[model samples]
Target: MNENVVVSADWLAERLDEVTVVDVRESWEYDGIGHVPGAVNVPFDSFRDEEGESESAERSGSDPRDAGTLPGAETWADLMGEAGVSADDTVVAYDDTHGVFAARFLVTAEAYGHTDLHLLDGDYSSWMREHETSGDAPDPDPTTYEVRDPEHSPFVGREEVEAAIDDPDSVLVDTRDDWEFEEGHLPGAVNLDWRELVDDETRGLKPRDELESILDAHDITPDKRVVLYCNTARRISHTYVVLSSLGYENVAFYEGSLTDWESVGGPIETES
Candidate 1:
C-alpha cells in the first residue's frame, strides 16, 4: 500500500519545487482565498463536465452536475494538458472538500494511466490552519498529455452496478452521509459514510486496523468485489483511496450513483 502518497503540509512545502501542487477547487474558490504558492488551478469540475459543453451529454439531456457524468478521455486529456500537467510530473492535488475532489483528480488521472500522483493531506484549509500561511495562484502552462484509453479503466456503469446487486461476490457501498443514505440509496447498497474512515481534525485517514474493523463489521472484506458510490461521485473518491490503500484490488467506482439510480426508477431502501 503506497499510503505514503498522502503528504503533510510541511512535507509538500519542503518539496514545493519537486512536485506540482495542483489546486482542485473551483475558480471562484481558488480566487476567493488564494492557493499554494505557484500552484496551478485545475478545477475538479473539468473531470465531470467539459466546461459546460458536453456534446454527448447534451444530446441525452444529462446534466453534468449529475454524479455519474464524466467526460471522455480525450476531453480529460485536453483539460489536463491545459492545466500544464506533463505526464512525468508528480501531481499533488488539493481542494477545500476534505481532499475528496483532490482524490477525484487522482483517480481520474489513474484512468489515463498517470500514476505518480499525491494528495496534500489536509488541503488548503489544513495548510492555512497548520502552517499559518497562504500562497497565490499561477497561470497554468499548456502541456500535452499522452492519455491511455479510458475504456480499459475500472469505472462502473449503472447497469453493471444494478447487476452487481445480485452477484454473490460483489458488495455495493453507499459512501454518502447517513442522512442521505436514510433518504434513499440503491437497493442492497449498504450505508458506509465516507467520513467515518477519516479524521476530522487532521483530514487524514484513520488507522488501518480501525478501518479494517469498521469495514469488516459491515462484511466489506478486501476480497469482495466492492462497488462504491456517493451523491455526485466526488466524495466517493475518498473511500476509493481508503479501500485502495487498504489493498482492495477489485474496487470500482460507480459514477452514476444515487441520482442516476433514482432517475431510472431503481429500487431504493429508506430508513423512514
Candidate 2:
C-alpha cells in the first residue's frame, strides 16, 4: 500500500493531536462502541445522495437503479463543514467494517479536491486491541469548506465502462466474491475479491510485496487504466482505495456498478 495514504495505528497515536480523526462508522457504533479520542463522527452513508439518485439523474428524469451515487459538490462541502473538516486539514478516517466505508470517504474527499487524505491501516477493532478508546464526542469548531473542480474524476459512468469493454488499455475489475462473479459479471471483466487485499488477522492491508504479487498475477499492473465495480459499488470502494494506495494513477470506479448496468440491459457473462 502507499505509505503516504495508509498510516499505522502507532503512527496515528503519535500525531493524534495534529490531524483530524474521522469515525465514519454508524453513529451507534461511534457512540456506544467508542471511538478514537477526539475523533468526529461522520457516518459513512452520509456521503451518498439521500434521494438515492445523483444530481445528473434528477436532470434527465432517469429512474436509474439506486446504486448510491454521490451527492453534489455543494452537499459534500456542507457535510465536510458540518463535520468540522476544513479544506486544509490532514484527515485520517477509520471504520469498523474493514476500510470500505473509510475508503469511500477518502475517495469522495479526493474527488472534491481534498489533497491531504489518509486511511487508518486497519479496522477499529484492530485499533481497540492496541490503543485506548473513548465515548466522548468532540464538538469541533466548524470551518467553511468550499467546493472546487475535481483534480481528477474518481468515478466513471456506463458509457465509459462500455467503451472500456473493448479498450485494450483499460482493465475492468469485479471486486466481488467468486460465487458472485461466477453467477454473472460484466463482459471482459476479471474477478479480484476485495477481501484478498486485506490481512484476515490484522484486518489491515496485506504487505506491499504480497499485494503487488497478487495484482501482478491478475495482470492488474500499474500501467493500465483500472476500473472497478461490485453489486452496488460499496464493496469495490475498498479495492479502489487499494489501487490508489498502490500508486495506480489511473484508477476509477463505476458508481452504479452491475445494478445500473443490468437496468440498462448491458451485457453480462456467467460461468457455464
Candidate 3:
C-alpha cells in the first residue's frame, strides 16, 4: 500500500495479480475501445450526485468539480469494496486525459485507510501503446460496494485560499486549459494547462526532458508552498499528484476551485 504516490506501468504489470487496476475513464472510453486486462471500469461521473440549480449536475466545460471529490472515509471504503477491492489490496487508478480522476480515486482510497494506491503514469492510451498487440476489454463489474470515511476529514476552503493568496509566500496555480485561465482566473495565478504537460500524440505525460523544460519555463522553483486549482477540483488534484510524483515536497490541491469561488459571489475578470 503506497500511501503517498503513483507507480509506473512496468512496476504495476509485474504485480498485476497483487494490485487492482481500476480504470476511472468514462464508460464510452471503455466501451468504444479497450482497457487494461482484468481491470475494473468505474465511471468518474457516477462519483457524485447532483444538487440544486447547479448546471454542474450535467458535466460542463468549465466545471472544475468532479463527482469524485473525496467523500467520507466510510464512503471511500464502500466504493473500493464494491469495486472488488479490499483495504489491503494495492489499487492503481487511471483516466483518459489526465490522472486527476485517478488521483481522486487514489486519494479517496487513502482517506478511506487504503494506502496502497497508485496512478498509471499515463492512461489508457499509454497502456495501449505499450501493449500494442493486446486487446483486453473488461466489462464493468457488477458488485455492491460501500465507501466509508472518518467523519472529520481535512478539506481546503475559500478562506484558507484567500489567506494563502494574501500571504505572498504561497504559489497559487490554475491547472486548467489556457482558454479557461484566460477567461477568468484568480489574481496572480499562473497558467500551466495540464494538456501541454502531457504528450497528446502518445497519450502520456511528456518525456522527462520536455516536462523539465516546461517547468523550467514556468520558473517553478522547487521550494515553495504550491497550491494547484482549476475550474473545479479534479484537474488540480491530478496536477498535485503529478507534481508530487515528480518529487515535489509541498503541494496541495484547492478542492473547491473556481466554481466554489463563484458560488461565494467572488469576482471574476473577463478577457478584453
lDDT of each: 0.75, 0.82, 0.64
The candidate that wins on TM-score is 2
After superposing candidate 3 on the true structure, give the runs of residues whose Cα lies further than 4 Å from its correct spot. Answer: 1-4, 49-74, 132-154, 269-272
In model 1, pairs of residues that clash are 68-255
TM-score quality measure for candidate 1? 0.83
Locate the minimum summed-lDDT window of 10 residues in model 1.
56-65
lDDT of 3 at 243: 73
Expressed as tens digits, the lDDT of each residue in 78-101 for candidate 2 is 898998999888999999877988
Query: Least lDDT summed over 10 consecutive residues: which range in candidate 2?
Result: 57-66
- Listed in order, each prediction's TM-score against the native is 0.83, 0.91, 0.78
What is the clash count for each candidate, in the order shown? 1, 0, 24
Give the per-residue lDDT of model 1 (tens digit) for 182-264: 98888788889888887788777777799899999877998899999886677788888778777788887866666566666
CA shift of 134, model 1, Å: 4.6
**lDDT, candidate 3, residue 28?**
76
- lDDT-based ranking: 2, 1, 3
